[model samples]
Target: MLSDTHPAGPGAAMRSDEDFVRAQTGIAPVPFVPEVRLHMAEDAIALWETTETARGERGLPPPFWAFAWAGGVGVARYVLDHPELVAGRSVLDLAAGSGLVGIAAALRGARSVRAAEIDAYAVAAIGVNAAANGVRVDAAVEDLLDGDGGPAEVVLAGDVFYERAMAARFLPFLLRARARGAVVIVGDPGRAYLPRERFAALAAYEVPVVADLEDAALKTTTVWELAGD
Candidate 1:
């Protein structure tokens, strides 16, 4: 759901990404992962409309960073509970919307954490959220899908299988990362394109979510480790 189109025109220039994010959201603790707090939007539709008005563009992608997705919640919870997985290790949070998973890793003693996102606004939100959590996350706008997953010892992806094109691209990248000996983990709510057979379930959680965004107040999300080379 990354968009190449950034905010433009005078209106967009006047309002910084951080300013827009703060103006549109309120800081609150995620229901399933209360140990972490985020700048979240109360209404998805309202925020989308506001973003459109500010950018003077229509059909822009939804603000995925404005909510703590069920998959991310599950992954963050699992990471916090099992600190050994990331402790003293480098972690790459791929397509990190709000950088929730990366922040959790940092809090759990990850040696280093890098959060990748293609959306500029999302990158800004990640920085803001990381600071709020008293963690340092190297948030950047980069698409790592085309290459082997960097030098990180661990790779984390959450809710990435929702779209067919994305899923197609993501699976290969994750497999390549796993092939390179990086522990690849994914959190998903059984999205349509998830290659379930390729992963082994490690943990599951009933993650509370925004009903309007996910169509369910709570999602049965699962954390899975990529299996096989």
Candidate 2:
């Protein structure tokens, strides 16, 4: 998930978002979804510091776009395995950090894919990562939580329930999308704020993740479909 801050920082004038992301990360295969590759950071703390230094700012959010979170990994794996869910459909990847899930949708033959992120750096990472995977994903820096989830037939959200405030807003947005006939899906690693009662579990997987980031080497992530009221 992303923070409310949107500034690219003062130093952003010197280096482009794509260039900063490339400089801080290395292209690598996702642990659980090896079929797709992404620009990943080697050290989370170091990269976070680097991003802050480059932006000439402190107290910025960590580089979430530089790692494949377990929730996102599980969602990407499910989409690739069950291509029927997104095949020939327009997909919206909400809070699409690293564009992992959206890229998977494209690889599985989604007619169109759009990855939405509030952070400009994440948007740039999405573009570069999609290109690395040989897929076309339109990445935009925008917050969609306030709107009826756009015009996509399939809506994918990963790791979005980790925060209380974000979860409050996101759950209603997802419910609105589902009510409007959009197929809404979410991938979560048992975050405290996830309203489990609002969704039905569709699939589960033991997703491998960076120990430094998740505290555990593996997370039991589940892919869920929003249930009707």
Candidate 3:
């Protein structure tokens, strides 16, 4: 959702995370995924600045957890419409900014859902967002990319191929999962690093996004499945 270049930067290890999210955002439904509601900020830059001041820190990763990204929204739409792909399966939302995709899986009746983020604050926001959407999503501050294939049958990753280092690490992890018989899917708004040739498009959507964050009112996002070798 956010530009990978955005210099950014949470809470307790939950309560304070919720408190901070509440203090910084307003509850609203994502325009494209109205089935879910999230605490969001209107101005991405302003919110990031305020977050820095509130936490008395600088150089924090952007408040990516505060907003719904176009990619995540698109992937969620596809999953909701194609419930059979995720229903009754174990799902993992890797690099889950707000746990949108994982929540969608849960809402679609996935047997279990885990949403992972490297940021602790985002981890907390995930919990709050999951509760608001009335879905039970397990939140963890983890680097799922650091391991071999996980146990989840389906893995949903949003906008992860924007940066070279991350993309490099993420793609191989996804391949490992695919090799293990996991269904790996990704939602990307054509980020620079997406390895298009390796994935097959499943769906596309014109996702509404914050102009401040995306520099455009809408972005065409695509859901792509990693091909198994």
Candidate 4:
């Protein structure tokens, strides 16, 4: 199981729009700003882009991906570095936070892309951002581990190894997908649950992340990828 020192408790599960907003801008770290390009998915759920001021002290802020989380950065870097991997394949982006990876796949010419996420707000955010980017993707509010996934030639997972419960639920599914002849790729930056032996390193990058939400601009995060065992 994965483990982390980050607290998880009441009001922990993004309960309010304010919480979402606070997450986006109140904690701006000095972003490393990679040159990775993205292609938005049209069929993905769409949510308005919200900023600290635009939220007006109410409504939800954008999701983690909107600001480009660590995992997203790593995946984006991989796609930009190796565009040919997705040029003509069907892709499944699991735990599709902000739908960035999936969008990248579509942008790179994937025949089809699906962004699967369980959070309604995240799903909506993905749809909105996907439209903004002008790509086509199917968005579904389902967990692949819950037996809700469909067949795809490739699967993308980003930063999902932070929580033990999540890792437990997700790893087996990824292994299963691998056994089924699908390419399973995960971008992680030393998350506790990442099974080093089960994957082969593909790439690495230094991504900026908020070390302290209150202090925002003081941290640099390292990100990496595991393409296969």
Candidate 5:
């Protein structure tokens, strides 16, 4: 498991809708649950920044992996925009961090959605977020491609290519699923390992990143659909 760094303190101030819209052009911190937001408010810890871990910081906090990027947002938008892809399909959201893509898939009318994550806190967050969205999703607490998992007609991965080691390992499992005839789709914001030609363009949208989340200075984010050939 990777290390986490959220600490307890005052709270991150809420942003106005105007500011949110403005910041939608850069990176942002998106919480998966009410409780998580409350905790972040209480601790005053920003969810997306790389900071020192606070003493006694509770469970695992949202990682960079949690938010939707241009890639994820695009794929999610495609899935939602085209309900025929999910209307009666079994879907698997691999590495479902904040569960945004998975929730989007469920909301788009998938017959069944299963969100799988390895982090304890993230798993808990997924359950809460799914409920909050009034969507039915099976939250699976396990690593990607572990066990004899059944095949899903569609698989979703968002912003998962950040780490070189992890990306190399993750590629084969995803390719294997594609070979099995699953409609594999990924959302990435040009992370280190994103191979441009692998995916066809779907859509582009600007997402928001919390002001306190990073030093990027720039706020809004760009999201894309990195799908297979």
Candidate 6:
């Protein structure tokens, strides 16, 4: 349990996105992917509680940007180690939490990096994190999956298969991107809903994670490419 004092309740007011994230987080290196650093929160649950009160609401989305998730770390490490995979190519980091994967791509010399996250707070966190690493990642708070892949040569998604409904929506979007010649890659720690048949493993990593956020302290994450594309 991480702790913070922001605000809560229906009457509490909202804070500026960038200021709130920056104020609540500190710059630190992700354990597995040390090549890039982010202004991350100390505790995932604490940040979520803070955000709920800060916006005067309950049931707000979790503060995923505060922590470096295992799946993101695995994909980011893969991207950093294999710069050639994205160098000089446009990339889309779907559900770009803290923009870690997108930042890795930008640092690795991608022609362009688009980090799309539906959570406004996550979007702000991505912008701050990118600046902390001295990289340019365009952060958009939109549901890009609702439509087709927009002009990206490669698509990198981290931990998007956590739930059945989310997996259903994500797999279809990824297949469409693959069909259009974009290389679609996903990093997952063997979540129950992942469509294993649709992906081929490219690399695997034992990513360190916070206990409060996962069932295990380490996540055996793997980067997989959409198969039969």
Report the Cα lDDT for residue 61, model 2.
80
Q: Rate the local accuracy (lDDT) of all candidates.
A: 0.90, 0.90, 0.86, 0.62, 0.56, 0.86
> By the lDDT metric, which is better: model 1 or model 4?
1
Q: Which regions of candidate 2 fall more than 4 Å away from where they truly are?
A: 1-15
Stretches of candidate 1 exceeding 4 Å from the true structure: 1-15
Candidate 6: tens digits of C-alpha lDDT, residues 1-229: 1123434531231246778988999888888888888888767777888888876678987887888988888899999999999999999999998999999999999999999987778988898888889999998778987776769999999889999999889988999899888998899988998889888999998999988889788989999999864
- Window of ten residues with lowest summed lDDT in model 3: 1-10
Write the residue-wise lDDT of candidate 1 on 38-153 in tens digits. 99999999998988887677987899999999888889999999999999999999999999999999999999999999877798899899999999999887899998787999
Write model 5 residue lDDT over 1-229, tens digit each, in one string: 2322322321211112112222322222333211111111211245423222321244544553334434445456566677787778899888876576787888878988998877544555565556656787787568766332256888888667778877876677777777677777776654678655666655454444344544342333233333554
Q: lDDT tens string, model 3, 2-39?
A: 22323333223256666778888888888899988888
TM-score of the candidate numbered 2?
Answer: 0.93
Model 6, residue 46: distance off in Å is 1.9
Model 3 TM-score, 2 decimals: 0.92
Where model 4 places Cα greater than 4 Å from the true spot, the runs are: 1-66, 213-229
Candidate 3 vs candidate 4, TM-score winner:
3
In candidate 6, position 5 carries an lDDT of: 46
C-alpha TM-scores of all predictions: 0.93, 0.93, 0.92, 0.69, 0.67, 0.92
lDDT of 1 at 8: 59
lDDT at position 58, candidate 2 = 91
